[model samples]
Target chain A: MARTDPDISPAPPATERGRRTRRKLLDAATIEFGERGFHEASIASITRRAGVALGSFYTYFGSKEAIFRDLVRDLSEGVRQAAAQSLAERELDALETERAALAAFLAFAREHKEIYRIIDESEFVDPESYRLHYEKTAERILGRLRAGAAAGQLRGDLDEAHAWAIMGMNVFLGLRYAVWSKGEEDRPEHAAQAAATILSEGIGPSDA
Target chain B: MARTDPDISPAPPATERGRRTRRKLLDAATIEFGERGFHEASIASITRRAGVALGSFYTYFGSKEAIFRDLVRDLSEGVRQAAAQSLAERELDALETERAALAAFLAFAREHKEIYRIIDESEFVDPESYRLHYEKTAERILGRLRAGAAAGQLRGDLDEAHAWAIMGMNVFLGLRYAVWSKGEEDRPEHAAQAAATILSEGIGPSDA
Candidate 1:
């Protein structure tokens, strides 16, 4: 159940039951950390919330910081899988691919509203994970942009800055339309379309 | 020195000397909070950094949290002023205005690298100020977008989502190019141009 990884945290559980226990702990930790924050959140509270014994907590995570770091990595992977699963369903054009990826992200954000809170909190609780999350995410976007550019679907000059720009656009759009707004007018589809339009055609007047 | 306002924090000092003291405390608090973070940071440390007595701390801030909130507001205003000052000297078109705003932001961010750390930490420490900061910043961008639309310089259908999109682009770009990268390749002017190009003409192929 304990495999040490130099990168982020300890390795995954070896058995199914162990995995289930770890998952429960993580789910509980998500709520604890999300609601109370890193400073106020406690290991005992997390164990109590998970319906697991305090002694068993050490089986998966070495410390509170370990669990928090793992949780951020888990969430980061969740974001990646959300988009990956969505992208696998169809062969989209470059612009459509970007739109689909964002749509998936928005849907994911709505389902797991704690995502923003937990991820934002990581900036303080685990600065390395926080930076790693964005750096990796930006790298993924850059890869897509490069592919699009090579395929002649996107502008030839697309670079890392462009990827960062697109990433920023998707993040804020999710923050507004997904996390903040409760109105029916602010659907993920609508947000996706607005973003897609920006990608396909800039906001400048056509005559310009 | 304190004027009670229903908004973010206490009002400005009536006397220049009092104003200077408050400014000193805020400046010192920036270093204290930036270095130690919110939880570990103390009022005594901030006062010590200010070269002022601990008893004089209350002359400006009612509590550590009050000063933290004020600091977030102050940094938010600083960001606004950075862009505002840049924009004031120019009579550029819509795209050029955005370019200037982003360039100014990038430059400001480079000088005050702690702006990112402080503003981001506010999400957990002071959620209201965090939300208000982005909301207000987005509103400002939206106003500019609307003005561009009205002047027929930008798309007439541009809305809040568009503003958020542009805001996100600028934020991440600043985070990457200004706060993170210490390399010569990541210049503010270059970032500004990349974003402006997206605003003028998106990532879509030119022939398309």
Candidate 2:
């Protein structure tokens, strides 16, 4: 297939077997890129990790840069799907929905610690993808905040800044509690509770 | 003069002229590394930008890596000093202090747009310095939060996680409003107000 959209993967595999092979390459690429970083990471190494023939790499990806870019998009999509799955399972109020989304994200980050490395590195290796990941994520959060305001669950004045603040909180919480947790008690749910509390009530004194 | 602390600069300049030269080199490195990135940035380019001799580069920094590491520290210290300078100018309450600090930060970021790139790239170039920068910043914020609680300005139950949340909020807000902003209306004070409102009342319904 001749895929024209540069933002997405080039020519997604047509057959099931082709798709499976592409998936394997992506999975392996994640590890290679995560471990070795963009400069040191090689197409041959990715193919070796994927157990695919080196020549077949071109069947799915145009170049190493192509695969790296696609992997970033893949990871961004993975984050969205993870949160979407969590949100779909409940009819949560706005605050509760945010809490669930954060919890789900924390879980995802902890499970795939490489996600932070890959995404953060994209800021240097592929600036456009790095900016897109955050812009898209913030837009999604802004939409949720507007919905919450419409439903009377959140302050009506909430805007883009609010969404950016919430996204920042979630990102750093995942960084500390999920990626750098030193103890078993520092769980995703604990971080979610803290973030949820911040969203529900400012850290100011109760009477203040 | 020989310096004992490896964590600090290689050696302390004994003369005012030497100090000025070192300062010039660091300023140049900031532009070089910020624009060209770490791996691509070179000592020769830094010297050219600084209007200093290449041999003089070694008088302050032992190597390119050394200067980058020191530059990260210098940037981190600069952020601390900015917040401290803002905090010292007033006797505001906890929330107001945060607002002032963030406002100062946004202003600083606007002036030195290269800061975000340097600090962020340190994650790959010098992981230890990157981690130390955040850990120390969070410690400082945590100390302020404890003081705020002690003074009855903030919630009594605030902890390390709360400090991280606030730090993340400030970092991302600076990224959006100061670094990536496209319009004139997106000012530092506006971002500070939004952050202050969140810190004071959160995004929950007003009644809550």
- In candidate 1, what are the lDDT values of residues A1-208, reduced to their tens digit? 5465433445678999999999999999989998898889999999999999998988788889999999999999999999999999999999999999999999999988788889998988789999999999999999998899899999998888988999999999999999997689787788888889889989999776
Report lDDT per candidate.
Answer: 0.90, 0.90
Question: How well does chain A score by TM in each candidate?
Answer: 0.93, 0.94
- For model 2, the superposed segments whose C-alpha errors exceed 4 Å read A1-9, B1-9
lDDT value, residue A90 of candidate 2:
75
lDDT: worst 10-residue window of model 1 chain A: A1-10
Native contact fraction, candidates in order = 0.85, 0.73
lDDT of 2 by residue, B39-128 (tens): 999999999999999988878987888999999999999999999998998799998888888898999999899999999999898999
The Cα error of candidate 1 at residue A36, in Å, is 1.4
Worst 10 residues of 2 chain A by lDDT: A1-10
lDDT of 2 at A52: 100
Question: lDDT per residue, candidate 1, B1-208, as tens digits?
Answer: 5465333345668899989999999999888888888889999999999999998877777788899999999999999999999999969888888888899999998998888889988998898999999999999999999999899999998988899999999999999999898698777777788888888888988888
Distance (Å) between predicted and true CA of B30, model 1? 1.4
